[model samples]
Target: MIRFENVSVTYDGSARPSVRGVDFEVPEGELVLLVGPSGVGKSTVLGAVSGLVPHFTGGTLHGRVTVAGRDTRTHKPRELADVVGTVGQDPLSHFVTDTVEDELAYGMESLGLAPAVMRRRVEETLDLLGLAGLRDRPLSTLSGGQQQRVAIGSVLTPHPQVLVLDEPTSALDPAAAEEVLAVLQRLVHDLGTTVLMAEHRLERVIQYADQVVLLPGPGERPLLGTPAEVMAVSPVVPPVVDLGRLAGWSPLPLTVRDARRGAAPLRDRLTDRQPRPDHTARPPQPAPPTPGRRLFKRTKPDTTAAPPVAEVSSLAVRRDRVQALRHVDLTVTPGETIALMGRNGAGKSTLLGALVGLVEPSSGSVRTGDAIPHRTRPRDLVRRVGLVPQEPRDLLYADTVAAECVAADDDAGATPGTCRALLSDLLPAVADDTHPRDLSEGQRLTLALAVVLTARPPLLLLDEPTRGLDYAAKARLVTILRGLAAEGHAIIMATHDVELAAELAHRVVLLAEGEVIADGPATDVVVASPSFAPQVAKILAPQHWLTVSQVREALR
Candidate 1:
């Protein structure tokens, strides 16, 4: 059981509390989902449960937080480790060991559990999280999604009574996310474990929550109720709930099954009308006629006749003993938006690395524009392509937000304040003096994206672009990307967010075991695969409606 009584948290530099007047009780053995927009203190709220807020984060806490009858105020994080297991948004920061098996057993070792019990629990967690194959892999060598599962398994192995997770499934692929969520469900139902999770991808987890805690904004009192009750008025909601609202369905559906049950008449309404093609509504703009320096300008005569911005042929990449990519081939053209999708460790990121010259292929060839990517200089590569990696911190080095923007401008040879302007467009009102490390995961991601976009490369690569973004922020991103695509920028994003692919991608390329499994139009690829389909697509099955906006467009 968890209880928060009149809780408010204020950091050392802040004038107002990040969260205030937040009083709630989460019953034992129940899963509570914390929902809110970015910067509304969802992470701060989760930190309070594990006593990381005022204790380690150097914040002032008003009122009380108790977990399993133990007062968090009196117990530090290490003191409460026996009962509370916390995983933050960044999983790389959570690991203390080198390998997966060691990381999973580290928690129990810290707790002074019996070696036999720790070993048994570690094996169980590895199997539960689908990490058995990755047990011997180094933490650094694994993919982002794999690291997330390892982070979760580390906590679960301790057999703590309470699990406090921040964006637990943000990095995972559809099937892996389902497996992790299913394990959590089993823990909640069969073992009476308590889970308090905050995730921006509400579509993946909203249906599984036992209760919902809605944080409207900073310092605002939270709204606690059943999932349907909270989603009705909540500012952030999944597509299924949005469809229910549009159809005027009583008690908004939380899952795809519920929405599909009532979708017959809505399906009839859309029978004659076709959903608009993704990213085709905007008219194409002509190139500036400035060769090499033109950003988002289509110099090609036509779509079918356009030359490829990046070309890959028989690409093979080997990292350690694993063949990260195997004989993969692909092509990108100006104005095309492609989504690279597959399960965790499926070579999506490795392909992006090949594009940006981060990973050298073991065999075969990769060419961006006219230069071989792995052999091209960084300065030369910036003009042809830019990549915002899965970990945004890799692109940021400055002490403050303003410094990073200025550095980005200098590095890209762009006009002063260009990166800042882009950052403002993506996420408004980030302070100039705020440290890059101090910003939330979503904010950091926005800053990193701004830094990459400053160069305005003809081709852009984004890995997990919507990891921590709320719906509003993601909409802003979609608009920005749409504008770029209209101007003829070729975009390739490696992501597991199916809703995002449905909303923005013109093409979908599914990879498996470091090979391309399927490549086709976005609708054709996602609508056929049950695991990859978005909520609306699943509900409107046999109809091919991929998004709520598509349905709204058809009706209008």
Candidate 2:
């Protein structure tokens, strides 16, 4: 059991508490979903239970928090480790071991458990997390979702009665996320692990949660109750829940399957649906189109060529003592957009790094023919390739947003004076001196992309670039990437947004434990692969389209 008595946490260095006066409890063996937009203090609440709030994070606590009758204020992380196992949004941040097997054993080894006990727990975790075949694999070799599962397995190896996970599926593709979520649901239903997890993708896991704790947006009170109860009164609800409300269904549908059943007057509703056939199917692209060689009109670049754009033969990378990429082979032809798919640890990022030389392959080769990617005299990768990392701010360093792009010589794109320009399409006051870091997560992402556009690289590598963004921002990113692809740039992105992949990517490269499990057209691989097909898309396709507009269009 977990209890919070009017607990309000305020970080010492901050002016306001991340979460305001909040109180809630989880009876033993209940799965609670804590949700809100990014930075709403959902993590802070979980931190309070794991002793990270006032301890590791160092904040002022106003009220009391008791976990299974033990005062949370007094217990340190190590002290609470046995009772609570926590995982964060980013898998790399919390990782300590170099291999999957070693990672599973790390937590137990730290607790000084018997070797025999540790071995048994490791084997059990491998089976429980569906990682039995990956015991000997290197941690860096698995896909993003696989890596995340490994993280979960490591934490669960201790068999903590209560488990707290923050955005466990945020970094995974739809199918991979579903695989992980299914395992989580099984943990609560079968093993009875008290689960407290926070996520932004509510539509995917809402039905699985026994309780939903909603931290309303600013100037609103937090809500806590059963999934149906809280969702009824809550400001943000899933599509299915909204459908239930609109359709006047008795019990709101938590899942899409239920939503379909509740939608009894579907044909009648379709008769009233209007048609907007002059519609555009393009993504909400963040960056404006780059000016190609033609000055008068923005002409499409030549996409078709004889040889492939990138070819990696027997590529390998080692992290610490473990091999991340073990003799992996991959190829991307000109004008092809490939979505890199895998569970969390599947060396997607590592493989991407080797392309531009961020990581040195231990053995094998990464060859870029005559037009080598970022093969410039200086390490100005922008000349050939542009990389947008998961955390957009990592590449940002400028006083004003406009100046940041200008620093990258974005002005090289003909005369901006020609159009009074649509730079303000994304940012309002693109003054020459606003610090990039001061902007919101969505704004910062747009700014970063704009900077990359200045480079005009033929090959673009985006790494989970949609993270911490809203629906609008995600839509914008998809549009931008698709526009770039249409204009002839070959994009390879390691992303967890499966819907984005389904809509934008032309091809997909599925990786598992650092090996290229499958590589081909996106439709063929993702549709066929067990852990790559997006759940929402799967639920809506064939009879109906997955996207909102697609359904509306079909009805029309």
Candidate 3:
């Protein structure tokens, strides 16, 4: 259904081609997964199929791309709307309407479908995507995952023969991600819809792909083969596949069920073992006052203890008719890392917003240090709290990475190059001269994080910080955040990355319908919930193993 022949894309003023000499074909009714590290131009290749690379993106394309026998070189995105549907990584940019139902119908209307046909498709798409309850909600009020679903529903309503998606399930919870994947499976098996997708979260979609495409890097020939064939050598793989490799399993498994079937021996090997002990530090206690201190004497400040950084008491946030959060109470002392997790639209983002003073509470209060975050001045608030929002671009406005770092330093009154130094630590491969827009999704997120950290706030909040990061990048992030936590910075992250939560978070707080339903230690919370359990935990059931690193250490 889609074909690329010797395709090469080079943006303006770039010496190297983003993607070079790529050749691949997707059968009429199969799913093809594009896998690669960050900054490898997976997006560029997907754009070529929808005729957006050279047309809308202002790039030069060398060779040919076709969808359903229509040459993309001759047809623009609008011209190929009936045959192709493209949903990008940033769903907010893809939206044209303000509400959910209208967005779903917009695509069908653009195709000049009859009113009856459009209405039928709208209802069906809403039900299929599990957006029925959110049908009337405004796009702005919805969470990141909900917006992603709406963006996908908008494209799916047109009933295009080919669907090109980038990071389709990055924002979704595991159960919701599974639901979306199941719908795609049905579309391929029952309706024969062709899907070409690029996803950083391989564990969610690897099992569903009929074939896998590996883009090793720029100027490297892309590898295309069956899922098993490609996974055997692919560097970027899901945790289950990694576990299979570690155990030398024959015919490496791609799904949890398959992994579990081959895990009998590994389970026996770990039968008497225990998971590594949790090592998250407790809050520091205040030191005793100095003895024999004269009254009103000049004294040095006590540096033994760091004060409470963030405290939310009975906080409630309401947007339009949706009560985003209700009676949410949280406290973060120094050196504690908390992971706020839940289903999509479960108030994770809302809680993050409240901490950073973006959302005004309908009731109760939020305190960062001695000041109320909602009422503090912007300049003063920067010293107390910093937030890396769900969409990283919201914090980036400069032309280049160096310029952004300079701007961040100026805004935070830090020494020159402080932000640049942080950027290098977070993402060393990104060039100093590269435009922020040119960076990949993971790179952009890291840049935003560096910008926020330049302020050195006592309380740090991150909303879906691991959205587009690969395993190596995620490992770097884990090291950075752990270092920050050890230095007495309180970190609160709102995320759907279960494995990340299991590995990095000291505690997990689960939300449901704007209410805190479960809150406890990370292992206790995740192991009890099947939807939130990591792959290793699922494969070795009742063993309480959360990560490969922990298991490796125990075996050692």
Top TM-score model: 1
**Which 10 successive residues of model 3 have the least lDDT summed?**
287-296
Using alpha carbons, what is the TM-score of model 3? Answer: 0.95
Best-first order by lDDT? 1, 3, 2
- Model 2: worst 10 consecutive residues (lDDT sum): 277-286
Give per-residue lDDT, candidate 1, residue 292: 44
lDDT of 1 by residue, 1-556 (tens): 9999999999988889999999999999999999999999999999999999889898799999999998988999999999999999999999999999999999889888999999899889988998898889899999999999999999999889999999999999999999999999999999999999999999999988999999999899999999999999999999999999999999789999999899999999988888875552322433312334433333442434456788999999999999999989998877789999999999999999999999999999999888898898999899789999888999889999999999999998888888988898889968999999888999999999999988888789999999999999999999888777776778999999999999998889999999999998887898999999999988988888889998887887
Q: Report, for every candidate in turn, its global Cα lDDT versus the true structure.
A: 0.91, 0.69, 0.87
lDDT of 1 at 429: 61
Model 2 bad stretches (over 4 Å): 138-142, 173-176, 233-250, 262-338, 342-351, 354-370, 374-378, 390-456, 468-472, 479-490, 506-537, 553-556
Error of 3 at 33 (Å): 0.3
Clashes of 2: 24
- Candidate 1 TM-score over all chains jointly: 0.97
Q: After superposition, how far is residue 452 of candidate 1 from its true place, in Å?
A: 0.2
Backbone clash count, each prediction separately: 0, 24, 0
